[model samples]
Target: MAASNVAAPLSSQRPLAIEARGLVKDFDGTRAVDGVDISVPEGAIYGILGPNGAGKTTTLRMLLGIIDPDAGVRRVFGHDRPHEIGRLIGYLPEERGLYPAMKSVEAIAFMGALRGLPLAEGRKRGLELLERHDLGYAAERQIRQLSKGMAQTVQLLGTLVHRPRLVVLDEPFSGLDAINQGKLEGLIRTLADDGVTVIFSTHVIHHAERLCEGVAIIAGGKVPYAGSVEAARDRIPAQVRLETRMREGAWTHALPEDARREGDFFYFSLPETGVEPLLKTLIEGEAGILSLSIERAGLHDAFVAIAGEAAARQLEADQAGGGA
Candidate 1:
């Protein structure tokens, strides 16, 4: 079993909105999840990331109490069963559907009603949300009449109508275009800014990288890593990118032994001796430095390093297959 860092050092001080331990799930005779564990801090944007069929959705279902785990335990806002606090939690599942016959605002209201908001209040808030989101014109339109992106936005507004404290979104960016994806990302940030805890699952590393403070990397029904995004990224060394007009000089000797060259650019891990000596060498050796930057490894690079290239490849394949 792989070790799990269920919480980051900083998040450990905050109250947790969700926690799971030794979560196990089986489908027929196949073990789909094996001893998965995760911790989500209150009012944080967390991500559960994995390629398709890696048990991302299954783990989320278990957390939301949509399905019972075969073994282990989970708690949402201190409730063993999430449904007991359903109104305080909002979920937008991977399989999205709204009534094609119902008007957009009515649909949002109806969804709010399911979460315990009164119909009249839901309808009032539904319209307000639509207008606030620039979807006021679509309020009276039937769901089937709206574009896919518009309909998805309507569903999302419904998810927020009851002002849930914690929101779980499964593959929320799967079908969105670049523009709508940006919009969703902004909305997620807004929610977190308002002290709402947002947890989303995605195979797209960029989305998780940009939006999540913490993440759990699930693979083959197990968690390989679960902690701050920064921690995951730190597992790989910071990369130093150096571009110089002079291809070769005495300054080349100052580069890390493992440094690789492509044209006039050199890429390598930041040297243990640090960059000051390197800059001095380059300047004195007259190595015509055009650009120099040292950057932490991005989440994509970290994902490939931690989850392996096969999982990374599958993630790319899944995104390509989804056409988003």
Candidate 2:
């Protein structure tokens, strides 16, 4: 719950995991990221959510030191730059690949070696992760023989082989089946529970709703909302819907003027006076209330509200394009 009651621009938690202040990036005079600010609390799963071309990957790369930001500051593990903090963070880029001829374990161990891990230790850790992730048998197999999902998991495992403190994934769920996505969600939760800070980028709002305690919604090269999932949802008003058998005009005065009526249900915001009095009035008026429910806005609705309807539509169109 990083943004529950933000007293300042950044998180107040001790030993902050990652921070980027007014980050901006440009290429060929076109800005991909513009004035973005983010704070990730230690030991929490944070999500960077946006539509395609929303500057998520650019911001992530800036924070990871893969590409330098044209403007602003980024801090990784209390350092101003990622140079000395390379071994402290694990990064999984959206682009996925490996040596097609290499064995799975060999690929993973090779990746760990680049992160300053010894070959024997990296192999041991890779084996442990393989067994833990139910891919022990695949360790001996070549990368070319694995399915797309399995290969993606192997890449993620390689990123995590050295057990870095902060794990940043870019579109980790892309091309994964439902089962693999669920398993990855569980793996993220496990990492947080183990005191690791995770930050991932995704266009799917539901993933952030289910897995992250904090989220940043990016749109059109800027962040419109960043904080706890609860706070983001709280940005929109709750909707009260009731289905009634009696559709007569008798209950009209009891409801708000802005209420909309559908086939069998009336939908509107609950008045400040509360639902109890409204329900009582409906009952006394002899309105047959078949069903009544109050539902808070979900992450998708909140994202649309915060990030703009255009961005949401773009995300939907992007999804359709990917599926096709």
Candidate 3:
């Protein structure tokens, strides 16, 4: 992990909203975020994606100033982080921040007030948000009385009541059912549409794929892939799988350059030449095609490929160091 000290002032040009250069954090002896460089343009819905123990939570904590990085510079809304974090950011931690004994309205209002909102205004916004999230009737209900999903909704409402410029959420969908997940995704989109910069971390790749305009995939505390979803998919190969009941010998010669057989199915890599010749050959061979479809690499595949490569490299390094 890189370490440096410069304590530079925030940028005068439209405050970055959030920026971290060579951010590094260590817990005990293990490095959590190692040399991470992240920049979120104002009003961009950026996603930080990684599997469990990928240091995503730690990175977000560093950004929020909940936890200090051992090294590197972090700024939130162009101000030195944590020092001015409350003024420009709203955070929803993975472990929901609510007092279980408190009523829904009280919990929401308390969170808003923590961000400097007056109690009366916080209560008004809390009630409105609760109603919007379909939990208005539960306003008087204690947090402990709510289901996990309902509590999650209240937590989200707390995060938004202040309407901070940048909202940072860590695994906001962890306890949500499909319906609640959809609801939260919609709300996130609405927030971004309202010109709020949203940065969130999630292990659920599909949600990130659907919600984020820009993404950074972190593995082993380092970003293996970062870009738009389309660009990430473009980094992988394109192939097509054709499943057929045709005789094995009949279409053997019609296979593409990188074709492979799995039982009755033929998985072929589409060559630059085109797929026309292969289709013609199969048709001429009188092959009974059960299904034929183009297979495009998805975000999940790209994530696995990149993370797998990083893990492999780490393994090799461990072995080399051991031998030395």
Candidate 4:
């Protein structure tokens, strides 16, 4: 691991919790993260989103100072060095493991000790965190004795022992059932409620869509959109579909020229004023409305729209191939 030394950033006036400016990384001559820039607000849940091999992990590693960027600068809490921030930030990597012989409490304390916390203090804090996470009874259990979900929770407990202000979880929802995934979502929300800035990277857009206030979509080692989640969704227009028994007439003329028609159904992009007026107009008229739906664009749609369908297809292919 490369060590990060404290250095004053050129601008100390920005109040961002995490900021990366034109970050770039290369491996064996191929760029993994190319000109990526991101700004994470304080006390917000932010997500770096992509499919496998989109360089999400590489970008995060650079920001955490685990690896130096080939170009650009990264600052967390206005400091250029992660070591300078130390216990102020907690990191949970995608690959999780624990010593089979180590007790849950002991494991947590060990992680804390690496960040300069005394054993007694670390244990005290670790117990509190474990209890808070509903793992109080399992504190003394060895890693090999706990269930898979319980062991994962214990590993997460170690990440929280020092009570860092910023927590970075890489693919935190991976390898868990839907129930456990929901539990993880709640835990993330609770952490943010305590004023901690939470940054997570995930290939699953559903998780990011539900939990993140802002997100950055990375495809092919490039960021297509970075800002509020709403902004990403707004990049593509919502789709309106009208399925009526009455198909052809003045009502059909109401649809845009680009509207796609199939039998008695009409599908088109929602107008700026939205479908309400159109619905009212149809209802006032004698058009027998069987079904009408306006499907708002989701993060996944936005990813395809902004990053291009080819990139989305490639991402899916990479995910299926088990590449990251």
Candidate 5:
């Protein structure tokens, strides 16, 4: 699909938790982010998706005030200066770290402290959170003593310790096993259920597709599409899949011009005239319609269509390089 076709700005009635316009950033002499515009609705699970080296991190950093944009304007929770509202936001950068010697509960408390939560309250909340999430056993263990997934979970718990209104996680699913990934997904849902605006960056489309209501598709530092997932998928029509008893018949004429057969099944885009007329034509033409199914295109298909084959290949190559 052409970029223009999917470029319609997403409109939401909810107040925006984060908004940026024409965000441009440069590092040294290289342009890392160019003309990125993002709008995240309050309490929505939004996603920033791009392949590695596509400036996802740079864009996120600029929004969080860790780095300044060379050209752009951004407002976080209505504040012109994002850092001024640091206590109201929780961020987990791609580069993960902790004081390895600190116990899990203490580490969570320390992170909370950095965000202005008192030590005693942070520790109390940290223990309660750990116990609530079935991590009480690891609460007293030092970070170095836990498994990688356990440590990552600890860090994530720390991100939530202060109970910020917005949470930003960069490549959070990285280095997690399937079980832990499922747990993280549940945690994200729970956060959103509690009305937290959760925005996460990931190259993995499945993660975003399953959890995000809105998404920004960034490639080579440019946002080609940013809108509701439904709008993105609707760029292409729903697909029709059919199986007939016979491969050749008059019914074939009713099939779309682009329809193709693979063994016994034929597939094509759903006809604009509607399936009822097509079915009538097929039945009258003696087409043995064994079964039929029509389904909306998934986010994976939509991503390929919107971002183009080259961008899809870039994502595949990056995932392969990184062991995803």
Candidate 6:
């Protein structure tokens, strides 16, 4: 299936926490976000994935009401956005924000208060969250004194301290190390498990695959694919890689329709008919098939296949214009 045909569920008929229709954004005569629509169901961990400059951030900004869309309708928790957004959502922008001179605990509590949390409860929750994220020891440390990773953690904690119904995180794992990355992933999952609708943007496709139940892959200012992770994987052809200890003269041409050689192994796409025939053919051909298993397409492969197609189309259009 083509990426462009991958459809997201409709918000109007579904119990959605976030919805946008015909979203459009223009910057200096260029369409940054073009007629995009998004629907995030309640309690879902949703991902907005794309390459750099693919309008993923722009769409997110518009959704958060940080920037206005030139055209479209948007709602958060069924409330009109940019207006009622304050009551329905929490946002952690790609650019981290914290007052440099403020202590970590003070900053987090202040952020929670800004989101409508009472000072006492906000301070208590702020301390708890900081401890949960392993930033408790740094609570008294000023923002400027903390390392980059520590600062980012403080900002993330602030976003979640208010416990808003919807959370929009832009590149939440941008600068974290492996340990911190795992920690953030855990927090994201925990939030979703608690019934918070999460809409996060990232260039790291693997994180989306691991953390989100559904994802929207955007390219060239449009959503080329959007659906459940399983559905996305299903759209791509399933293949298998086989490693064998066959003699040097063994022939593998008798393999399945999409079979090819990569070093000593044979790679082939599994036909809907099954794997028995392919295995039998290899055995009959005197190929020593040591191990064989189906190779599932990873999110990286899916992104490459979908985004590459869009880029090719754009190149073709540009060339045609040049010729004209």
What is the TM-score of candidate 5? 0.95
For model 2, what is the error of residue 290's alpha carbon versus the real structure, in angstroms, after optimal superposition? 2.7
lDDT of 1 by residue, 1-324 (tens): 233434444345779899999999999999999998888889899999888999998999999999999999999988999988999998998888999999999999999999999999999999999999999999999999999999999999999999999999988897899999999999999999999999999988889999999998877787878889999888878889999989988888988888999777899998777889999999999999999989999988877777778888888898779832
Worst 10 residues of 3 by lDDT: 1-10
All candidates: TM-score: 0.92, 0.92, 0.79, 0.88, 0.95, 0.85
Candidate 6 residue spans exceeding 4 A from truth = 1-5, 8-14, 243-254, 262-264, 277-289, 309-324
Error of 2 at 97 (Å): 1.9
Clashing residue pairs in candidate 1 (N, C-alpha, C atoms within 3 angstroms): none
Q: How well does model 6 score by local distance difference test?
A: 0.80
Sort every candidate by lDDT, greatest first: 5, 1, 2, 4, 6, 3
Q: What is the lDDT of residue 228 in candidate 3?
A: 65
Off by over 4 Å in 5: 1-5, 8-11, 246-249
Scored by lDDT, model 2 comes in at 0.86
The Cα RMSD in angstroms, rounded to one decimal, for candidate 4 relative to the true structure is 5.9
lDDT of 3 by residue, 227-295 (tens): 566666655677888987765756777787688878877887776777788778887888877888887
Runs in model 3 lying further than 4 Å from the true structure: 1-16, 242-255, 262-265, 272-292, 309-324
| Per-residue alpha-carbon lDDT of candidate 5 for residues 1-324, written as tens digits (9 for 90 to 100) | 426434545566899999999999988899999999898989999999888888899999999999989999999999979998999999999999999999999999999999999999999999999999899999999999999999998999899899999999999999998999999999999999999999999998889999999999988888889889889888889999999877888778878998999888999999888899999988888788899999998887887887777888888787666632
Better of 2 and 5 by TM-score: 5
Q: Please, what is the whole-model Cα lDDT of each candidate in the order they appear?
A: 0.89, 0.86, 0.78, 0.83, 0.90, 0.80
lDDT accuracy of residue 83 in candidate 5: 93
Model 2 over residues 157-260: C-alpha lDDT tens digits? Answer: 99999999999999998898899999999999999999999999998877889998888888888887878888777777788999887898577788987799
> C-alpha displacement of 226 in model 6, angstroms?
1.2
- Give lDDT tens digits, candidate 6, residues 43-122: 99999887667798899888877789999988877776555558567888887778999999888889888888887888
Q: After superposition, how far is residue 225 of candidate 2 from its true place, in Å?
A: 1.1
TM-score of 1: 0.92
- Angstrom error of the Cα, residue 143, model 4: value is 1.5
